[model samples]
Target: MARYRFRFVACDEGFLRTFAGSAWRGAFGGALKRVVCAMRLRPCEGCPLAGTCIYPHLFEGRQGADPVRLKSLDRIAVPYVFELDDVVPRSFGAGSEVTVTLTLIGDANRRLARSYP
Candidate 1:
């Protein structure tokens, strides 16, 4: 079984679990495809459900992830880092990028999504 490393530049977990599902090889023992990840949301802002959301409980860290969801299978949609533009300094914001790595175990799938440019 091969595990993966994901570097979600300025992106959050929710986006990966939700919208991107239609784009790429989703977490069904998925593969590490090319992605232009970026974190657009902040802990204090962005997510409307944050006020009463249980994301904290679902996720392991303050960033929150669904371990039960992750452990359910041998694979996961791991959105490790969340980078935001507001926090960036000048060129950093424009140059910053998100990187994700996935280690394929079995029955991996992939569908590339068009991002950037």
Candidate 2:
């Protein structure tokens, strides 16, 4: 397991609404998919690379190919989580900054470095 922190500074004026967790998650997921998806399939269903792709494992909660695993367990939890500040402001002006923490659990920490480089 490993934790990483990323900071983003607004180059221009921007508004981040209260309870922006979903927005952040959506943006992160979309960007990650774009970075990792090789086939660029929309649904990602029946793709030959589904078993090995990091996008489905991270975003779609896909399980491994082991058949002995519990049938009742459908999907596993995502291997990463986003930690946001407790008191997020409603908006930001130029030069404003926000810090987001990303924790990679289990195999995710190992895959992250290899996935990109």
**lDDT accuracy of residue 34 in candidate 1:** 17
The local lDDT score (0 to 100) that residue 20 gets in candidate 1 is: 40
Best by TM-score: 2
lDDT for each residue of candidate 2 in 53-97, tens digit (9 for 90 to 100): 778777887764552454466578888888776356567789988
Worst ten-residue run, lDDT, model 1? 107-116
How accurate locally is residue 92 in candidate 2, as Cα lDDT from 0 to 100?
A: 78
Best by lDDT: 2
Query: After superposition, which runs of candidate 1 have C-alpha atoms over 4 Å from their true positions?
Result: 6-17, 26-93, 107-117
Which window of ten consecutive residues has the lowest lDDT sum in model 2? 63-72
For model 1, residues 13-70, the per-residue Cα lDDT tens digits are 2233333423333332222211211223334245554322333221212222233344
Instruction: Tell me the number of clashing residue pairs for each predicted model.
Output: 16, 0
